[model samples]
Target chain A: MIGAVPARDATLAERLRAGRSPRRRAVDRAGRGLALAATLACVVPLAAVLFFVVAKGAGALNLDLLTKPAKALGTGGGALQSWLGTVQMVGLATLIAVPVGIAAGIYVSEFAGHRAARAIRFASDVMVGVPSILVGIFVYVLLVLPFRQFNAFAGSVALAVIIVPVIQRTTEEVLGLVPRELREGSLALGVPSWRTTLSVVLPTARAGVLTGVMLGVARAAGETAPLLFTALGSRLVNIGGFGEPMDSLTLFIYNGARSPIAALNDQAWGAALLLLLLVLGINVSVRLRSMGGVRA
Target chain B: MREDPVEMSVAAPVAAPPEPQREALPTAPSTVPGGAPLSLAPPAAGIPGAAPATVPAAKIEIRDLNLYYGPFRAVRDVSMGIAANQITAIIGPSGCGKSTFLRSINRMHELTRHASMDGQVLLDGVDVYSPEVDAVDLRRFVGMVFQRPNPFPTMSIYDNVVAGLRLGGGARKADLDEVVERCLRAAGLWDEVKDKLRAGGTSLSGGQQQRLCIARALAVDPEVILMDEPASALDPVATLRIEELMLELRGRFTIVIVTHNMQQASRVSDFTAFFSMGEDRAGYLVEMDRTARIFTNPREKLTEDYVSGRFG
Candidate 1:
């Protein structure tokens, strides 16, 4: 029976008995090569930016730039005061934003079955889509105008407004990613719904939630527009309360970049590099934590 | 001329009269032993307060049960008595309410938002549908195995088996370990999985996953077990294993299974109930009888036609 068929007349199965044909095989190889080329094309620009930042900024980085006060407009300077102001303002913003944002996200994901929940979710989405500059203007009106001056507290409020949407959206998405089956299983076991959410669902989605928080920090850390109208860029950092004007890394970069002196320009690059490194570190740590969760 | 001479000495025995034979036929019309006329009548007259003479007092009784999804009635007036420690298999084709009926027994149907039922499901002489009876407690006494094996993917095999027991309340470590081992052994999965009890339940093969589900169900120590197409998703070998396990479990728990496999019903069940869709496409119980008689000599022509593979 096998011998009755001609070699070329073999069954379709026999034709496919080996692997791919030479022409098709070559095509597959070419397809893979094209994919690799496209990937390299996308990565090259990022690599160039990093290289440029390191080359220019590395020359200006020093302990003095980190530890001393900023110089006046005509002289060589430092970022110590700017760094302290950035820390205080951002810290306060984070403290205000994280809890409220996360709570709102949880409510939307877990309990928002009614019209109020729908309204909150819709409002949050709209807020997130709104321009950051608009948020700064709103905060400028609400806090800076009423107070009759730009202060650290006004800056923090602007930053908080921006941070809220980022944190809220991320938290909601992460909580939504937790499987419904897990929640159902917990509830079926006689655990109260809220307890199940807190102990089971939240714990399972913790890695994603942490990643969201990190992203929120990274976003709020580099915001310049909101800080401009609120903090108003003081040359020397003042570590006082809501009434005192403050300086941050972003404002320092903005101001130094606009200065006529070569020293100020150099200082801007150094501060930019510092901000980049902090954001990068946060991102990498979040990635590592997420991977650790998956492995476990 | 020879026949005439031979007939002269012949004498024949007289046959009985037709009237006597007719009278005897009425008396022998299959007496249901304990012989209650009321029990023999159709359920349309409604079962009286007197105990059902057709079967022993039901371990589980469903009455005037109607299930709906939105406005569509999926099942209507499904009343049946499930006897204790017996394997009762509900067999029907697709879309026939066998699975729905099984789910309603433990109120698992309540999980669907659009689903609703008007009924009374009694367990051990108490109405499970009563407002005072907790659904969670009902589920504890009447456990279910779904068509597909859904052992929680995140939980380990050991945890999957102990989930129900732990959910019941506090269990000592020694007692838990013993119960887990016993349930696994009862499911015929202990030897294969004992060494890897800590492995995720999802890592098991399809057959092993089904067995793990059975083990999970057994861990709760349910008095009645409801299985909805438990072996339908399994291969022939796995199906056989589940059939064997059902037979073994029948010694302890009342097992009510819904299956499309007639051969499986005949092989495992002592009693079989046949269901079919009515004119409205709503499912109803057509007939129920001893497994052997249902297949060989069904009283309902519809059942005989279905069992004989002439129609479904």
Candidate 2:
């Protein structure tokens, strides 16, 4: 620490001088300052958005928003139907996508031989970049036209299509991260390749895979473009089935924000806050799981 | 498949008639006469391969083996007979394909993409390369412990021990407890781990985890256990413990180990095989002999130099 050389600061100054020059110290301080500024730049906008939504919406956001319906629009109406529809469609989408995405991921990372896997990988990367509105249009043509209706099932199909590629990519990357040593150990015990994957490989990558699923859910929950042509929106509190048109927070927010009524706009802001909370909750829980969850 | 003396003699056991064909088969076995070798091969410190004139009963017969990682031949034309219930150590410098030779015995080498092998590895004198012999089944009888201790992080100690039996097929629900205890006991881990059987395998100390892996290998009751520098990642005491455990396991399973530690080879192995990379970068067997003879009086100059630490 160069304790013998310093007089004014009892060796602190000498230690600092020995470790880093003045220019290097200044550079380090500047680098730290830049990093903090960058972090704040990201966080400030998010905080502002969250605060704005809550401030405008908190009055309308009550228990009635969950339990009651938006029966009297342009009045103090709740969005019970919209919330339920959002839950149903997102649930269906998750159900449809999770298994298929994880399976595709396993195929790409584990048994994928040569060019076919590469092509599938390439396709998934491209899929992630396709415009969300374009995906909505694609689903509209495929499902809405085929069924001759804008139904909850069609909405779910759109969300699932968007979610599948994201989850699959994450599963592939995390599964690939599992060290080859474990595979060999399992195989050396005479475990078949499929069983090894199921029992050992999949479990090891479980947290990361779950993170992917949650990320997909968050992304799909916030999407308004895909739902515009699928679920459309309805005033009914409880739609009969997947065949019926559904009401979602995003769709309601989209329709209400442009309305002239102040009450309707307040309800839209309330729905946005609820949707934001749901997405943020999923993301936060996923990060928590990733930090200290059961890892193989 | 060709009716060579070794193949013809070995084939009799697999295809023997139910009645009396087995009686005549054991009389003139190629590796041993009357099949006493597997049971009666006494454990003496490095005595099994002591005499160059007397060859032990070969449990595994690897002939003209070549291993390739794509176009790059990692190991070339290597042939060695591993004795039944005896420890054989393959010692060499880094990238010498000693570990490759070890992995190819159970076909673990084939797991890598584009990895290919040309040759025959006979287990109980049956060609493992034959299409009829499933690699999965071959691995059941010929197990391997890696250089790094890889206890399944997802599993408890009890589960990790019985992982082989569970996933490797032939595990009965009723026998799981017994099998886990037996394998752990055999691996010299029962006394330390019996109380916390439900604890995660990864929570154990490094040596304990390695032992847990060994226990996992033993869960399926393999006849041959291949170790690739099993103690390299361990501390000195752990290394000594593992070496001692190998000595104790000698008469139960045929052991083939790859080690960079020459003292360990001298201390633990019955037979020592030296591998060196040629100018082509393909590893070849330089010499195979009794540990005592190879360490003291060697045939190959390369073996002597390596043993003396004159050069890698």
Candidate 3:
């Protein structure tokens, strides 16, 4: 059995029992509806793209598509050469970009003086905003012109240039979030500044840094314009060396999409789906691993 | 802890002395390598209450120290001797440069951008700021604990304790294990954390985390430990435990603690230095004396007023 509630509790219960006025309730519902509409505005385009890609590309998938190289105009072979080139070029680009990007990030966040840090940050921002095609042209002039060849190395260089600024900015932001207290604590224990940064600061921001790297990798893997000037798409596989022309999934999609034949266009859709899945798979796996990765 | 003030107050009246006494130098002046002469005489200006009472052994001597953050003076003209094997508490209100003064002892203050200090902070009679001394090397001799518990989030309980030792280069696993156990026990956290030495440092509660930070500070075996309000974030019970830990460790290390809690200063410290901000917003030492005398019968009117709750 319950006894009489205290005066304060009684008042609180009475207040709880009261409902908002009709005008206020209507306003609340309208606000919630607006929020839902805004959310759908963001999600609808993404859902539509995924739905159409799967619908159009699923029938094009086959063993032949996987096994054969590109055939002549209108006729189909496969994206074997393109897939391999993408793997090699993007892989090399990652190797070049990650270390340089992370090092530059660390310098800006942990070591650079005020004016120097500002200048570096400004340069990175400007690099990020520069058009991807311009990066391709820049690399063409820098590496292609100097070497007298449109080679996979120049394509990888352009991709790496594109990736570096994205990774650098993200790394700097993530490292900035690592608390100042952690650095001070480590330094007070007689650990040098550089050691503290490597051990304590970086590890704490590991998951975030990995996320940034994945974003950079995904962007580099999908870039077609940059590869156009440098890689100069090849129908035959060029796997012997970086000095030869290369074919990537983006180039395959570009060529197939523009072809007059319906079959090549379908294959283009298939390759787009494949590239999207590959990037998605890498991102999902990395996110899951990082979630369970380190306590920091 | 409640009974502490009562017992100390009873002893306070009996322990009062008529005149202030200077702390005797702990060791001979020759111990200062490079023959840096020890200035035995008090400062010529003889700032009031600067040297109010005696301490057992002087471990660190600060002479004419003025700390600046860019153009603003934070701590001005502080001269004092921190006693070895004892806890010296620095008490002041907010923005009074209490933490700045503590950081200067370990040269941690210089880590802040635009932060600088002149005059001498002598560790074993050698100026720590001398061109020959490396700040990194000097930090090995003086460890510090911040107000917030900052156990490395990336490390486990055991790893956090050995983070400092790991820097000197790899040590035998057995040696690290021993250091971990010894420091945890010294911080009064061994029994609670021993079973889960591999657990994340952040898995512990607020109180336990603070104790872990203390254990981390102790791991390097520094001769002096500086605490900047180490327990201000904890509950009263945890605060008492930290105070007890400081008291127990006083026999082995020189401890300089900056606290906002007056009762904590009166309870845990052997010597108390009261700091107050001047009109220009620069903090300076108002009085330094035995804990008992400083609380019971301070010589300066400002010290008495602040202690009695008349004003800050």
Candidate whose TM-score is highest? 3
Q: What is the DockQ ranking, best to worst?
A: 2, 3, 1
Query: B269, model 1: CA deviation in Å?
Result: 3.1
The residue-by-residue lDDT of candidate 1 on B187-242, one tens digit each, is 88999999988888878988899899888776666668888898999999999999
* Candidate 3, B227-269: lDDT as tens digits: 9999999999999889878876765667899999999999998
Runs of candidate 3 exceeding 4 Å displacement: A1-29, A72-74, B1-47, B50-53, B168-174
What's the residue-level lDDT of B194 in candidate 3? 96
Writing each residue's lDDT as its tens digit, candidate 3 over A1-296 gives: 11232446467767555555566777899999999999999999999999988989887866677778887544868988888898889999999999999999999999899999999999999999999999999999998988888899999999999999989999999999999999999999889889999999999999889988998999999999999999988998778579989999999999889988899999988888888888999899988887773373
Model 2: per-residue Cα lDDT at residue A230: 84
- lDDT, candidate 2, A36-134, per-residue tens: 999999999999998999998887788988687877544665888898888889989999999999999999999887888899999999998888888
Rate residue A274 of model 2 by lDDT. Answer: 87
- Candidates in order, TM-scores: namely 0.73, 0.88, 0.89
Off by over 4 Å in 1: A1-51, A61-111, A114-121, A137-192, A195-214, A229-248, A293-296, B1-53, B164-179, B307-312
What lDDT tens digits, residue by residue, belong to model 1 across residues A156-212?
Answer: 988888788778877888889887656555444434456556766676677777777
Model 3 docking category: medium
Query: Candidates 1 and 3: which is better by lDDT?
Result: 3
Candidate of highest lDDT? 3
Task: For each candidate in the order shown, give its overall lDDT on alpha carbons.
Answer: 0.75, 0.82, 0.84
Clashing pairs in 3: none
* Cα misplacement distance, residue A254 of candidate 1 (Å): 3.0
